[model samples]
Target chain A: MWQALYDEVKNEDFMIIAVAEESRGNETAKEWLDLAKPSYVTLIDREHHVADLYNMVNVPQAVWIDEHGRIVRPAETAGSHDAWRSMNREDMSMPEESTAIAAKAQKTYMDAVRDWAINGTMSKHAFNSAQVRTHLALPTENVALANTNFRLGFYLREHGQVEEGDKFLKIAVDLRPESWNLYRQAMNLREIGPNGFAANEDFFARVDALGAGRYYPPPNIEGFPTEAGFVPVS
Target chain B: MVTVLTEAGATEVVSAQATGDDLWFAKTDVTRATGWNLKPEGLCQGDLCVPVPKANSENFVREETVNIAGFWRLLGRPALHDQAGATWMLGASASDRANALQSLEAPDFKLPDLDGKLHSLSDYRGKRVFLTTWSSW
Candidate 1:
């Protein structure tokens, strides 16, 4: 999807930098990159450095930077929706209506990106500096501490200290529960489930625990859907 | 041996001393682990110097060693460690991160592509960038 967009605007002095926030290292990220064969720049991030620097709490987040290296948009959910929460657990099937809404939300987001790419600062989607700053999600003290613990945990685990690594990984999650990237990555690295079903169950349960909160908070942009079109299951 | 994690990567502070929660490093190791050098004026990284508070100078500096964690706390940055203090990770101060965002300048970073080729965000200057992140997990 990003590749297609990048192709459309590559000649307009627009570049797409896709970073894989995979701590398991290059091989894991390389497989997907090879499959896509994206023409744009693709990089592997084992340290979650980009996430830490940008204060991103989830995957598929994006930031917009103008030609002069100024941020026109801070990190936000990039064309993703929480419609997956409405999927049928037994069949792993999504309702057609939910799928359509999800597709529409994604298209809306992509269109906004295309607008910004072509029109640059003149685009309505391109936020001014003040608006960009307002949208920026600066890390809190706990979030910063969580990032530290997350890095330490990953480092220790990579160095063959599983038990000690898990300790800090758990602490990282506790320090910043809002960071799904930290929580999910920890679960992934630890191989929390013996099988896919157990992992799915755990993920579903966490989503359920959100209550009224969104799994993917809709991006605050013009024409963006404000709701996931379904009330989250309590 | 104490391992200090910074943006420049991990450094083993062989001469580090751990007292309870604090990790003290030789003045030389301070510059090795972190870019900041301990000069007579205070701790400095490049031209940015943060002076040790006169009232609590002992908290940051003690003879030939400086409390690495204390220096981070003094600068309002997060300094974290394990129970044994064998490993430590220093995080940027909230104010510093926030200030960068407030300035609206995209924080530049260098990362490696699949082929091991490195690319810095600044390398794409004069071009609009759509910087996005994903995970295979």
Candidate 2:
């Protein structure tokens, strides 16, 4: 999907740089990169620095920065295709109703991206300066604390201190339960018994709790004046 | 293990753990851990300098260690140390955020590519950069 976007906007003035938000360079990353062979710059974010800088709480989030280095659009849900989302919830086998609805509501962010890429700031897809500022989430006290805990947890775990790491990791999850990567990475590394970190929740269990529909935050699609036009999880 | 990335694209490493609210770094490693070195000019990092409070000097710099939380307080930045004393994190001060918002400039940060070559947002100042964050899982 990203490859298609790259090919479509390859001649545009702006550059599309994809960041891998994995904790470290792993085999899956290498395999995907090799298979896709993206022509655009593909960078690795072993420390999730971009996530921290952009306030990204989930994967596949895109932030548009204009020529002046100012963020014209804050992080929002982004996907290149809507093929799978076209299916009706009734046709799906997923047990959770919300999950099925969410799956169906996914939108193609590439349309907005293409418009902005071709037209620059004049694109209707681009939000104005004031709007962009309003859209940006201010760093709250809890967010800052959560970020610190995540960093500490990652650092400890990386240095062969699993028990010590889980202590801080649990606090991080408690602080930012919506941030998927925080708990995702933890679950990937451990079995996480009933007393597991993060409110004793695992990945699948939490998703079930959120209902599949609320898993991904709705895309802040450009030109959608009414909230109804936004991605509908229900 | 703590990794500190300065706005100027410098990276510092500090091996310390929080034993409470206090983060203890080795006395010999304080300078390398934080760009600011202990000196008469207060704690200096490049041209940026912050004066060490006379009252908190002892707590800031112990016999062979530095209390990162205390030192960060002196520098006017926010910091946190884990309960296990196994990790620490520091964030920009309120003033820093205000300045960035006022100037409308994205904060500069450096991250390495797959090959470990560093890339700074400042490096792409003249070009429009689309940064997308994704995960395999």
Candidate 3:
């Protein structure tokens, strides 16, 4: 867990730069950050410019850039080695078909991160060279298109154009039927009419576990609490 | 879940089309960025809120005329008008288009430690920061 690692490293003198494009203070997220008491810096990237540099498509992405600022290695989804079930996975029950497939995917992803971290460029998992080509090949053309659509949808939503956002969201969902987050985002915005406000602010903010008002308030509208003594209008 | 807190509360959900101060479209002024309480009580869905007056019985009604024009100018929210009325929605006040990875980055955020000083990403420039975000199973 990056948090666990951050906690371990923050006490030292390491300056951790966490770039986030979303607002923080989700109830639970705040709680954990509090508990960790990290000494490093966490940056918010509302525009996600930093993420563009790292070529990151998701959170928990990491790249070990040396002091010279050169990426010692390409980006990776950081995970602890011990987090894996084990390289020598034996027979496991095929619970539900979906769960079984998920298990397999999880193993592959975990193994990749562990191997990459442990060996670095030399690690068998590093796909920087020819040997890595087989496993580390980039996404195909279709997959790339899907990613683009999803991105466009996000832009539309954050820009307050839900219908346009939904068009891309729909394309993304059709492309990656298995992506949970993508599906979740699309589903949330699908029914949001041009006139409808995202009422799910309660749902999403709570999903992040931050007890707060909706994530983004209507642009420029400032609402505050009235004086307590004054009688409320009916 | 519904509550009948007051007998005189108006239930009609008025959609404001920003035209002018008097008959100004409501949409012209109110935005998602400021807060959408719908109710006069100022109880927005998330952490953000707009201060409005309300009684226990009519939390969702507009008890007072919002200074729509003032907010329109102050916040600079986008506005749209047609022959009949004008409409406005919050602009992307913060983030724009993002990828899964980009969106993964929560906005730059720091909170007061037990000591109460604000903290930020610059605080940890030299050291490696590993921020692990997780969900409860």
For each candidate, give its TM-score against the true structure. 0.94, 0.75, 0.36
Backbone clash pairs for candidate 1 read none
Model 1: per-residue Cα lDDT at residue A180: 77
Tens-digit lDDT track of model 2 for B30-124:
67666567667666778877776677677766676677667776666757654544345666554555445445566667776666787777777
Docking quality level of the chain pair in candidate 3: incorrect
lDDT of 1 by residue, A62-151 (tens): 999999999998999998888767778777789888888788889999999998999899999998877887788888878777888888
Off by over 4 Å in 3: A1-4, A10-13, A20-37, A45-59, A80-139, A176-181, A184-234, B1-137
What DockQ does each candidate score versus the true complex, computed on alpha carbons? 0.71, 0.46, 0.06
Weakest ten-residue segment in model 3 chain A by summed lDDT = A217-226
- What lDDT is reached at residue A182 by model 1? 84
Best by DockQ: 1
| Collision count for each candidate, in order | 0, 6, 55
Q: In candidate 2, what are the lDDT values of residues A96-172, reduced to their tens digit?
A: 44344433444336677877877788987677878877777655556556666767666767778878777877887
Using TM-score as the measure, the top candidate is: 1
- Full ranking by lDDT: 1, 2, 3
Candidate 1: which stretches are off by over 4 Å?
A: A192-199
Q: Per-residue lDDT tens digits of candidate 1, residues B1-137? A: 99899878999999998887678998888887898999888988888888888998887788898988888887888787777788888878767777777888899899999988999999999999999999877
